[model samples]
Every structure is written in structure tokens, then in C-alpha cells.
Target: MNLNLRAAILHNVSDNDQSQLEDTIVDAIQSGEEKMLPGLGVLFEVIWKNSSEDEKKEMLETLEKGVKG
Candidate 1:
């Protein structure tokens, strides 16, 4: 059985509305499970890929601050 984690994650969440997506992310984080990291990463990848340059820079800044703070 070849399980593609990224594909699976994307497929599951792709149809979700904004509120559903936010809930998924919130639940994943609040659960504090290491297994959820890859799913979150996949979500971030989609968001990053679709973002504009300004959005990416803002995200980077937010990430940097998050890492520091």
C-alpha cells in the first residue's frame, strides 16, 4: 500500500470552507500530536504556493516573529 501523505492531506481538506479549514488547523495544533505536522506542512505549502510576493513576505515575517517570540 503506497500512502502519499501530502496527497491524502490535500485531498481531505481541499473541499473545506474557510471555517472548516481553520477548525482543522486549530484542532491539529491543540492536539499537540507530532503526526499532524506533515498535514499542517501540506496546508502551509498550498497557502504558500498560492500567495503573492507581498503575502509571502508577510508570512515570512510572521513566521520569523513566531519562531523568536
Candidate 2:
């Protein structure tokens, strides 16, 4: 069976409102389950694609700090 994980993840969360999306993210993070990493990666991919250069820089900076911290 061929599975398109990115598509499946997007389809599941595409209709979520801001609050629901927040809940989904928080729940996924708090769960610390390996399966959730792909979902978060898909979400970050969408965010990175839509973000401006400045936003991407800020995200990189934050990620760097997070890694160091």
C-alpha cells in the first residue's frame, strides 16, 4: 500500500480553526509520540512555504536557540 502521509496530514488539519489547530499542536507536542513528528513536519513545511524571508530567518533563529537551549 502506498501512503501519502503529507496529504493525509494536511487533509486532517486543513479545516481546523485557530483554536483547534493550537489544540492539535499542543496535544501532539505533549504526547511526545514519534508518529506525531511527521504531522508537525508537514505543518512546518506549510508554514515555511508561506512565510516571508524575514519570518523564515526568525524561525531559523528560534530553532537555533531551541537547539542550543
Candidate 3:
């Protein structure tokens, strides 16, 4: 079976408002299940593609802090 996970994840949330998107993210994080990681990664890829260089830098910095914690 061909599973286009990134496309599937994006399509699932494409119609969501900002608050709904936030809730989805929060729920995924709080759940801490391995299955959620792929969806989060797809979301990050979308953010990375659309982000300015400065925004990418900030995200990396935040990620660095997160990892260090």
C-alpha cells in the first residue's frame, strides 16, 4: 500500500483554523506517542518551507533549547 503520510496529514488539517491547529499540536505533544511524530514532522516541514531565514534560525534555536532541556 502506498501511504502518502505528509499529504495525508496536511489534507486532514488544511481546513483547520489557527486555534484548532494549536489544539492539534498540543494534543499530539501531550500524547507522546511515536505515531504522532510523523505528523509533527510533516507540520514542521510545512513551517520550514514557508519560513523566513530568521524564522528558521529562531526555530532551530528553540529546538536547541528544547533538546538541552
Candidate 4:
């Protein structure tokens, strides 16, 4: 079977409004299920690709703090 996970994830959420997207993210993180990691990673990939340099730097800084915390 051939499956494009990134595309599938995007398709699933294409119609989601801001609130729905926020809920989906919160639900996925709170679930703490291994299966949700890939979807989160894909979301992060999209965010990373679309972020500005300053935004990326901020994300890295936040990630560093999170790791240290």
C-alpha cells in the first residue's frame, strides 16, 4: 500500500477552523499516544517550512528551554 501521510494529514484538517485546529492539537498532545507523534511532526514540518527566520529562531529558543526545563 502506498500512502502519503503528510498529504493525508493536511487533507483531514483542510476544512478546520482555528478553534478546531487548536482542539485537535491539544487533544493529540494530551493523548500522549505514539501514533499521534507522526501527525504532530508533520504539523511541525509545515510550520517550520512556512516560518520566518526570526520565528524559527524563537521556536529553537523555546525548544532549548523546553529541553532544559
Poorest stretch of ten by lDDT in candidate 3: 38-47
TM-score of each: 0.94, 0.97, 0.94, 0.95
The list of candidate 2 runs beyond 4 A from truth reads none
Q: Give each model's clash number.
A: 0, 0, 0, 0
- lDDT per residue for candidate 4 within 1-69, as digits (tens), equals 999998999999989999998898999999999999999898889889999999999999999999999
Q: Candidate 4, 42: how far from true, in Å?
A: 0.8
Q: Point out where model 1 deviates above 4 Å.
A: none
| Cα-based lDDT at residue 23, candidate 4 | 90
lDDT of 2 by residue, 1-69 (tens): 999999999999989999999999999999999989999999999999999999999999999999999
Best by TM-score: 2
Q: Candidate 3's residue-wise lDDT over 20-42, tens digit each?
A: 99999999999999999999999
Show the colliding residue pairs in model 3.
Answer: none
Residue 46 displacement in candidate 4 (angstroms): 1.1
Q: lDDT of candidate 4?
A: 0.94
Q: Mark the 10 consecutive residues where model 4 has the least summed lDDT.
A: 38-47
